[model samples]
Target: MSNYSTTTLVMTRVFNVSREKVFDAWLNPKMMKKWLFTLEGTNKVAQNDPQVGGTWEIVDHRDGKDYRAIGEYLEIDPPKKLVLTFKMPQFSDTVDTITVQLKELEQGCEMTFTQDIIVPHEETWTEADIEKALGEYHDGSEHGWNLMFMGLKELVETGQISYKG
Candidate 1:
């Protein structure tokens, strides 16, 4: 087994909304569930209170398989910033830090989502393994972030929650 250290993934989106509106979505649990899971086959997902030290869990099914993600909230800020702990089941027990930053732009708000983690120094993931993991991650994150920003825009413009099923 070869050692594995830090792995980081960064994604950015420009949403036609204000920074305040965009930040509120991450601080609210009900708003988060709307766009957090964008996979094609995901089922029900539930999130508890979204505050510092809060816990959350999600159950997703795809291709006749079930997977769960359980984690805790590490930091919370209103309408500006957020940080959370992420975990994946039946895989490496890696600890991840996710940060969402909102920047004001002439057109709208620019949001950046970054996920960083450090695996065991002695662990190794083959090229195929890395590719598979990243594929799933990209699918989930892109969909999740897009949906989240959508919900944020709706809430700010419509004054109602339209993302809920």
Candidate 2:
């Protein structure tokens, strides 16, 4: 049996907007800042050459510390799908690809995001730490994604960016 494990997080949101507009929001920095990592009143995101092999970074400042993450794009298909690598500084070198898809419904547009991660060595985590970390990550995943979706909705509906959380 394999000793590796993978974690998959899927989130879906319905926005009252077009797929193209939704897609552009992610690709655009002005739109991204309105939601991306805006929690706790501190965050930053920057993307360079946001295509395949393109670079991206987000610097989060909080509690008198700076946590930085950098990555690159693996695939890009406008108004449909996007795949990108994600990496955090000082952590193990793990490549994560975020797959985002856009679908149109009578009510609005449906945006689905799936993040898949392969943890090479689960033993590196103690049982207690593993449990705590997993719980925290799961909770953050839900909260963070919801925030992003709400931001998107606000922008599309009001022609202005707003964050309720």
Q: Which candidate's TM-score is highest? A: 2
Residue 127, model 1: lDDT of 67
For candidate 1, what is the lDDT? 0.67
Candidate 2 lDDT, tens digit per residue, 1-165? 255445677898888878888888777766655555553256655445778887877676777877676778888899898888766756656666678999988967899988775454466677666566656655666676777677777876676764433
The deviation in Å at residue 98 for candidate 2 is 0.9
Clash count for candidate 2 is 0
Name the candidate that leads on lDDT.
Answer: 2
lDDT of 1 by residue, 38-140 (tens): 2323546756667799987766676676667777888877666778877776676876788888888997788888887545542367766766666666566
lDDT of 2: 0.71
